[model samples]
Target: MEKVNLVFGTVYGSAQFVAETLTSKIAELDFETNLIQSSDLTGFVPKEDELLIIVTSTTGQGDLPDDIAPWFAEMKSAAPYLPGLRYSIIGLGDSSYETFCGAAKQFDELFAELGAKPLTARLDIDACETMEPETDAVQWISTWHSAAQSLNQ
Candidate 1:
C-alpha cells in the first residue's frame, strides 16, 4: 500500500488540526498516513512509492512556524535528494497579510528545486474568517489520490 505522510509546522494549533483531519481522511481512503511534526522530520524522506503532504502555516511577516524553521533551513541548505517522490503543500495564512501563506509557498518552491514532483496543485487557505482550510484540504487530497491512481496505471 502506498503511504501519505503529513508533516506540519503549525502556530496557534490551527494548522495542526488541519493536518490531522487530512491524515484521517487519507487513512479512511485506505492509504497509510504518518503524522509528524515538522520539528521531527530530521533525516526523513518519503519512499519513492509514498506521497508527502506538507501542511504549514505562516507566522509574523510570513515566516514559517518557529518549530519548523530548522527543517526549512536544512532543506534549503543541504538540498537532500528525494528522487521519485511526489508531494503537495497546503498553506494556512491570513489573506490580510501581504504574503499570505508565504511559508508554504517557499516550501513548495524548495521541493521543486530539489526535484520532487508535486502530485497536486498547491492550496493556499486564507484564515478561518474567510475560508475553511479543513474543507479545502479534504477536497484537495481526494483529488490528489484519484490523480495519483490514474497516473500509476
Candidate 2:
C-alpha cells in the first residue's frame, strides 16, 4: 500500500486535530498513514514512495509554531535534495494577521527549494472565514487524494 506521513505543527492544537482527522480519510483511500509531530523529526526524511502531508498553524507575528521552528531551521541549513518526494500542506491562520498562513507558505517554499514535488496546491484555512477548519480541510483532501493517486500511475 502507498504510505502517507501526516506531519503537523500546532500552537493551540488546531493543526494537530486537523492532521488526526485527515488520517482516517487517508486510510479510507487505502493509503497507510502515519501521524508525526514536526518537533519529532530529528533526522527524518520522507522516502520516495511516501507522501508528506503537512498541517501547520502560524503563531506570533507570522512565525512558525515553536514545535516546528527548529525542524524548519534544520532543513533550511541542510537543504537536502528531495526531488523524489511528493508533499502537500494545509495552513491554519487568521486573516486578520499581516502574515496569514505565513508558516505554511514558508514550508511550501522550503519544500520546493529542497526539490520536493507538490502533490497539489496548498490549502489555507482562515480562522475568520470558518469556525471549523477541519471541514474545509476535509473537502480539500478529496482533491489531494486524487492527485496523489495519479502519481502512482
Relative to the unseen true structure, what is the C-alpha lDDT of residue 1 in candidate 1, on a scale of 0 to 100?
68
Tens-digit per-residue lDDT, 1-153, candidate 2: 899998888999999999999999889988899998675687777787799999999998889998888888888998889999999999999999899999999999999999999999999999999989999999998799889879869
Task: Identify the runs in model 1 with alpha carbons over 4 angstroms from their true place.
Answer: 128-131
> For model 1, what is the alpha-carbon lDDT of residue 12?
84
In candidate 1, what are the lDDT values of residues 1-153, reduced to their tens digit? Answer: 688888899888878989999989888888888998766787676676788889999998989998777888877888867768899899999888898999999999899888899888888988846456788788787688887787669
The lDDT, on a scale of 0 to 1, for candidate 2 is: 0.91
In lDDT terms, which candidate is top?
Answer: 2
Candidate 2 TM-score to native: 0.96
The worst-scoring run of ten residues by lDDT in candidate 2 lies at 37-46
- Among all windows of ten consecutive residues in candidate 1, which has the lowest summed lDDT? 127-136
